[model samples]
Target chain A: MSARPRDPMLPRSYRIESVESELPGGEVFSWTLRPRGGELEVGQPGQFNMLYQLGIGEVPISISALGEDGTLIHTIRDVGGVTRNMAALSAGEEIGVRGPFGTAWPVAAAEGHDVLLVAGGIGLAPLRPVIHHVLANRERYRRIFLLYGTRQPADILFRKELERWRGRFDIDVAVTVDRADASWRGDVGVVTRLIERGGFDPRNSIAMVCGPEVMMRFAVMSLERRGVPARQIYLSMERNMQCAVGYCGHCQYGGHFICKDGPVFPYDRLEPLFDVREL
Target chain B: MDDLAQVFAEEPFFSGFSDAQLRRLAGLARPEVYQNGRYLIRQNGSADRFMLITTGHVVLKAFVPQRGMVPLETLGPGDPLGWSWLAPPYKWHYDGRALERTEVIAFEAEGLRQAMEQDHELGYRLQKRMIEVIAHRLQAARLQSLDLYGNPAGDLP
Candidate 1:
């Protein structure tokens, strides 16, 4: 670590190596940055990048996947103008990138404890890194559980990978859908219901939850009720983040700047402000 | 066969009940097996019994005017299904169907009702559990209606 502040504000040119459509409106972009003429820095999982769409605007998107050969993956859902444009991007196109900013999941802290990673819908994107990290070093952690809930079967991201992970004996993967058609023979309900049958030792467990605010609130409540300490539970928050640094006031939460301070914070620190509604 | 008392003790719905109370509950339950596609309970049907599933899967669904049967939840072992038996008029709100061959213990509503009436203490305990179930379901239904994941927009609570 140098105090050099490497490429803080300058935009790097990342060539989109591949683009894959997920579900109906979602897409995943794989990029290999050639900043001036070199490789882009490897970003830690749970971190985000400021992606610039030239004339449109820049949006902070989380690092969804990391390639073994050093590529950055971003999963985008077409919600607004920037995201819609991101979805329309084709392979070989180049996008401007600012950084892999903000804090990351507490992977080290979760070691030795049962790791429960819970995600809902597109919320799974951010937590994908944690999944990769845990699986890569499976021996360090205790039981690794992933409880994911999506809107429906078609809406599930990383479908092939989820199936692969589910097949593993060392990991516990429980997926539920909000609604199911006749074809879906899997579990159906809110994700929290899975916790009742999840069988994790709450006292020695660390839970990471990411999803809609309402969904996250309920997940946190369930974990808390099961005797998991508020300190050990973590939540990846959703907010309007601009600048991806502390310079702009766009993503301020009470006193914290989500861009620099956190997108991942312990439930104990955020308990007071978790769902204040007016905040 | 799964021991009845042990099975009853494991359900979260009956987690804190005393062993004596749990034994009485186990005694009241009648074991039944259902094949796939069987309707354990139907909407608007008389809810004369509630079921505690020990093995296999059951789906809770509601039929909309145009949407046929909309699956709400697929419950598995250790789940308590149908609280409508405790409420007035006693009609099932949703259809409970076995998606696969299933094993469950059906608790007779009339017998339990009579037992409760005879023993006010038992009635109070059972009523407390039913109220908890109703409140929990109300909260779940409210969350479902929010449809938070269906149409997601960023930058808002």
Candidate 2:
């Protein structure tokens, strides 16, 4: 039998058009990338893209939002080596991309139901695409609720978008901070408290959450306690992803590979992995 | 009046407080228990409360798939669990799990904030104490990291 050829590391090439500091806070950085020549794959909300910094390394970053001009947007924090290198890249630089990987947000399934979006810190990057998709097809859903939490007032990502979402009648947005300075006048508690204050009918709502593992678990627990079914809740997970493809074991959580099986997974699928800690 | 009071009074952070202040602080805190493997604070979750370990040990863990639950540090009596509660965006930086059956005295963050608002002197004292605790932990972590990556000290006993 003939052996299958190994997949190439450079799956697709992307051109960086612009980089913008989306949040006034020092944490979030937004970048615009356009595929060179070839058409980019259409991605679902909650899906992620693996970005490689030419000479540095590749890291899995969630697609923040899609632009009307065909450019894919990514919101990243300058945390690790790969992201730090990415932040230093100027406009017109080229980077590598692997996929529009993982199962997307249940946008189609969520039609006709109220949708709740919960995000913490950099977790907002993954949930932003879902929000855009929901708002674009606004007529399909009954109501949309967004709850976001950050470490401090200055660290809130997507400040402009958050304000715009707050202005819209179709979506109710609530934000909280774990700690706040004198400038902050909003709720000064955990994001879970915002969910309690939002008063959504969990029975009729599908909740999507992204953030650090701890925040996602607590958010899901809070939602479940409010009557939201585990099956209806979706969570975006973060893991050290080497190959965007399933071949690498870096992103594995129990039996599932976060890169291939999901960066987005139903809450029930996450249950067994929750206590595993390392997943 | 309670086991928690006895433990709280002995903590280094409470050493400077007068007996009356210590009693008041104890009154503002509540004792809680956790079984082995229970999470006290989850990574990236809101850190709206602060906990002081009274008995047993808890592991400060960070999940990195390759190495599993990377034990960042093992904390025991007198250590504070959530420093983020002292600063804004009070989100937990990492997950804290009880390595054994543990008891803790948790101070409600909002109540502390309210108390701070009423008494600046008490607030300053507490904040200074908390900062010192954070500094000590950071130094300990740095030292541990050095031990992990530093040159070997030859011919150990």
lDDT of 1 at A266: 89
Off by over 4 Å in 2: A1-8, A24-27, B1-157
Model 1 local distance difference test score: 0.83
Q: Of the candidates shown, which would achieve the greatest TM-score relative to the real structure?
A: 1
Residue ranges of candidate 1 with Cα displaced over 4 Å:
A1-4, A25-36, B1-3, B153-157
> In candidate 2, what are the lDDT values of residues A42-117, reduced to their tens digit?
6777788778887788777888888878899998777666777777888899988877887788888899899999
lDDT of 2 by residue, B1-157 (tens): 4666677677766877766666667777888999987999999998888898878777666667766655555566666777888788888988888868989989888788778778787788888888876765554444333322121234210
Native-to-model Cα distance after best TM-score fit, residue A28 in candidate 2, in Å: 2.5
Q: Model 2: how far is B153 from its true place, Å?
A: 27
Cα lDDT computed for each candidate against the true fold = 0.83, 0.77
What CAPRI grade goes to candidate 2? incorrect
Q: Looking at model 2 chain A, report the run of 10 residues with the lowest lDDT sum.
A: A180-189
All candidates: DockQ: 0.50, 0.02
